[model samples]
Target chain A: MIRDTIRPGTILRVLVLVALIAFLVAPERFAGLLAPLTTNNAPPIYNQGSLVDLTLSHLFTVAISTLAAAVVAVSLAVFVTRPAGREFLALSRAVVNIGQTFPPVAVLALSVPAMGFGEAPTRMALFLYGLLPIFENTLVGLSTLPPAVVEAASAMGMTGRQRLLKVELPLAMPLILEGLRLSAVIGLATATIGSTVAAKGLGEVIIAGLLSNNLAFIVQGGVITGVLAVLISDGFQAVARQAAKKSGTRPQTET
Target chain B: MTMLADAGPDEPAASWRIDRLGVVIALLLVVALALPFATFRATRIASGTGLLLHEALPAPAAAAAAAALVAALAGAVTLRRPALRLAAGVLALVALALGVGAAAAFLTPADNPYARIAPGSGFWVGVFAAAMLVTDAMVRLRLGPAGRLIALAMTAALIAALLASGAWSRLSLLAEYRSRADVFWREANTHVILAAGSLAAAVAVGLPLGILAHRVRRLRDPMINVLNVIQTIPSMALFGILIAPLGWIAANVPGAHALGIRGIGMAPAFLALFLYSLLPMVANTIVGLNGVSRAVVDAARGMGLTGLQRLFQVEMPLALPVILTGIRIVLVQNIGLATVAALIGGGGFGVFLFQGLGQTATDLILLGALPPVALAFAAAVVLDAVIEISGRGKP
Candidate 1:
C-alpha cells in the first residue's frame, strides 16, 4: 500500500522537477515552442530577469513567511490548548477563523500602506495570511488526540510536559504537518501577488506578461507556479501519510 | 472516564476564576498608549506624520479618551459579571472610534482640500482589541443565533449613524469615499455580482456534478483531482493564463465580443471565480450526501421509494446543512477572489485597491478593501445562522 502511493508521487515529483529546471535553466529553449501563442511581435519569453532568480526569490519569500507563521501559530495553538490557558480558547479560535475571511490580496494591499511597497509588505501579508490554517490545524491536532491514549500516558506516569512532547505531539504530527502544508501552498500562491508591489517572485513574470500582452511569459510563469504548488502539496501529503502511518492514525482526507 | 473524573471537580471553578477579558483590555490599553493615534498628511497619497493621542486631539478630549480607556481596563480586571465586561468593551470601542474621528477633524485644516488625516496604528489596534473583548463576552454569554444577529444589526446601525453624523468626514478614507461615491457603489455592485453570480453558477452546475460523482464511483477521484489541480494554480497566474485563450476566442468567435467575452474583463474573471467555486460546492455536496445515515436510507428503500425519490426526500434534506456550508464557503471565497478580478478590468472593489496601489493612496485602498471584508464576514455569519437553523430542523 505504501509503495502504491509513494511510486506515483515519486514519478510526479521527478517530472515536475525536470520541468521546473528546464524553465529556470533554459527558458529561451521554450521560446520557439511558445512563439505561436504570441502576437504583435511580442517577445516569447520574459527577458527582464532570469527565471532562476525569480523562482528562488519566490520560494524564499514563501519559506520565510511560512516559517514565521508556523512558529507563531503553533505556539499560540499550544498556549490556548493548555489547561492554564484554556479560558482564552474561544477568543483565539474566533480570531483564527475570522482572520481567514480577509482575502490575502487585500491583506497584501493593506500591508503596503503601513510597510510601504517591496518585499516587506508581501512577507507581512503572507505571514498574516498563513496564520489561520496552521493555527486551526494545530489546535485541531492537539485537541483531537484520543482521550484513551492521553489517559494511558497519564496512567503510565508520564509528566504533563513529557506526555505532550513525546506522545501527543507525535500523534498530532500528521495533522500539524497538514496545516503547514496548507499554509505553504497558500503562501506560494500568494507570494506571486507580492510581485505587484515590487516584490521579486514568479508573479513578476506573470505581471510582466500581462503588461506586454506576451502569452509565452504568462504561460511560463503560470505553469511554473502551478507545478511548484502541486509538487509541494504532494510532498507534504506524502510526508503526512508517512507520519500518520508511523503513528497508527488515518491520514485526513483532503477537503 | 478517569481523566474526566480527575478534572471535573475543579474545572468549572478554574475556568471561571481567570478573567480572560483582562488580557484583551490590557492589550488594548497598551496599544492605545504605544502607537500613533492618527496620521496627519500634507496631501493625499503623501507619507503622513504619526501623532500620539496627546498631539492629535485637544487636551481635554485626549484626557477624556485616556480616562475612558483606563476605566475599561480597570473594569475588565475588577468586574465579575460578563454583562459589566461587555459594557466596558462597548464603551472602549465607542471612545476609540470617536477619539479617532475627533483626531481626524482636529488635524485637518479647515480650508485645505489636499490635507488628509487617517487613523494610525494605535487606533486600529485598539479597535481590534475592543472588538475582541466584545466577541469574547458574547461567546462567554452564549448568545444564540438571534442574539448574535441582533448584535450584528446594532453594530451596523451604530456605524451607519457614525458615518451619517459626519464625525469621520475629515478622515482620509471618508474623503476618498466622498470623491468617488459613484464609482464606489458601481464597483461595489460589480464586486457583489461577481461573487454572487459565480456562486449561483457553481451551485447550478456543481449540484448535478456532485450527484453524478456520488453515483459514479469511477468518476469521483478524477473529478476531484482535476478540481484540486485547478485550485492549486495561483489566482494571479490563473487570471493571466486565461487572457491568452480568452482573447483569441474573443477575436475569432464572431459573437464573443458582442456578448462581452473578451481577454481582459468580466468574462475571464467571472469564469475563473466560477471555476474556483466548484470544488467546495461539489465536495460539500458529496460529503453531505455520504454523511446520510445508511439505516435511514434503507428504511426509505423498504418503503417502496425509487432511488430518485429516496435521494430527494431522504438524502438531500439530510445533506442540506452541509451543502449550505459549502455554499457559504464558496460565497466567501468568491467574494475575496472577486477583488483580484479588478486586475483584468473586471471592475470590482479591486479597482479601487489596485488604483490605490498605483497612486499610493492609502484611503483609496481602504475604500476598496473594507467593503469586501465586511461583505464576506456578513455572508459567513448569515449563512452560519442559516446552517444552524437548518441543522436544528433535521430529524
Candidate 2:
C-alpha cells in the first residue's frame, strides 16, 4: 500500500510542496538563482517579513472569509429553496448575479472607504465577493436532487429537518464543496489585493516589489501566490471528488 | 435552471396578496429614510458630517420627496398591475435622482471651492431599493429583448439629461470628473483598448487553437489544463510575473523598446489579460464545436463540402451561440481585469481608483470604479441579448 501510494503524481506533488516550503523558509538561499534578473542593489528576497508568515496570513484570511461566506450563502440558499421562503428567490438570485460582475479588486477598493484600511475590510470584501459561487452552487445542488430520493425519504416518515440534515445535505455535499472550493480560490486571489488597504498578506510582498522595482520580490510573491491558488484549488477538487464517490454520485466536470 | 421561473401559482385578480419582495424593498426604503442622505465636507478629502434628508433639502422639496417614498411603499403593497408598478418604480427612481442632486446643491455653499457634498449611505440604499423595484417590475412585465434595450436606452437618456442640466454639478463625484475630464476620457480609452484589444487577440489565437484541440483528440485535455493553470494565477501575480521576463527581452533584444514592449505598463498588462482570456475563449470554442451535431456535419459532408467548408458553412453557424457566450465572458472578465493594469501604469480606470485609495477620496474612487462596473454590466446585457437572438434562429 505504501509503495502503491508513491506514484509519479504523488511524487511530483511532494516535490512541489517541498520547494514551496524551502522557498518560504529561506528565500535568500535562492537569491543567487535570481541574481541574473535583478540589476539593482536591492535585496532579491523580500525581507520586510517572512514569506511563511505572509502565506499563513493569506491562508487565514481566505479561510475565515470563505467560511463566513459558506455559512451565510448556504443558509440563504436553503431559505430560498424552502417553500415558505420561496417568494424572495428572484430577489436573491438577482443580487447574487449582479454582485458577481463587480470585480474583487474593485470591491476591495470600495470597502476601504466604509471599513478603513485593515484586514477587517479585506475579510468583509472577500466574504461578500465569495458569496456568489457558493450560494449558486448550493442552490443548484439542493434543487437538482433526484425527486424520488426525496420522496423516498418522505415516504419513510422522515421529518423535514431530518430529511434535510440526513438525506438532502449528504447528497448536496459534493457540489457544495465544489462551490466552497471556487469561493476559496477567489478569496485567495482577492486577498493579495487587500495588501493595498494595509492588510497583511502576500500582496505586501508584491506591492513592495512593485514600488521598489525589485524583480526578485515580485517573482517570489507572484510564484508563491500562483502555486498556492493551484494547490488549494486542486486540494478542494480532490476532496469534492472523494465526497462524490462516497455519495455514489458522479463527480462534476469542471467548466 | 427554472428554479426561479415564477414558481408562485396564479391567484384570483380580486384577492389581496402581500408582495413579499415589496415588503423587503419597503423595509430598505424605510432604512434609507432614517439614515443620512449626504455628507457635508469642508474640503474634498476631509471627513464630513452626515446630513439627514430633511436637513439636506428645502422644506417643501423634502416633504415632497418624503411623500414620494411613502407612496412608493404603499404602491409596493397595493399595486397589482405590472404596468402600474413599473411606472411607479421609474417615477420613484427619477425622484430619487433629483433628490440626490438637490441635496448636493443645497448642502454645498455657493462660491466656495473647498466645500464638497457627497451622497451618503442613505442615498445609496435608496438607489438600491429603487433599482430593485424597477428591476422586479420589469421582470414581472416579461419585457422582450427590444423592450429591455429600450428601457436601458431610456435610463441612459435620463442620466445624460441630468448631466447636461448640471443638476449634479455640486456633487463631489462630478467635481472629480470635471477636474480630470481629459485624463478620465484618456484612461477610459486605454481601458477599452486593454479589454477589447486583449479579447480580440485572444480570439485570434484561441479560436484556431481551440479548433486544433478539437481536431487533435489527444491534445484537448492538456491544452485545456494548461490554460486552466494560467487562469488559476491571480491577476496581480500574473502581472508581476510577466514584468521581469518582458523587461529582460526589452533590454536584451534589439528594437523591442521601439516596439513598445516593456516590463511595466501596457505591454505586460495586455499580455497578462491576453493570457487570462485564453482559457475561456479556447474552452468555449471547444465546447461549442463539440456540441455541433455529428449528423449535421455528416449531412454537410455528403453534400461534397470539404472539411474547411463544412466547418465554416455548417458547424460554425451552429456553434456561434456558444462561442458568443465565451466572448461575453471574456469581455466582462477583461473589463474588470483591465482596472488592475493600472497598478503597472497600464493607464485605465484603475488609475483613478488607486489614486483615490492613496488619497482616501471616496468620490474619486467612485469616479474610477463606477464606469467599469457600468461597462461590464452593459456588456453582459448586450451579449446575453445577442446570444439569445442568435440561438433563437437555430433549431
Give TM-scores for every candidate, taking all chains together and pairing residue i with residue i: 0.95, 0.96
Residue B61 of model 2, lDDT score: 89
Note the residue pairs that clash in candidate 1. none
Stretches > 4 Å off in candidate 1: A1-13, B1-11, B14-21
- Top candidate on DockQ is 2
Candidate lDDT scores, in order, read: 0.85, 0.86
Q: Model 2 scores what on Cα lDDT? A: 0.86
State the DockQ of every prediction: 0.51, 0.55
Off by over 4 Å in 2: A1-7, B1-14
Taking chain A of model 1 alone, its TM-score versus the true chain A equals 0.95
- Give one digit per residue, the lDDT tens place, for model 1 in A125-170: 9999898898889888998899999999999999999999999888
Under the 3 Å rule for N, CA and C atoms, how many clashes does model 2 have?
A: 0
Candidate 1 CAPRI assessment class:
medium
Proportion of the native interface contacts kept in model 1: 0.55
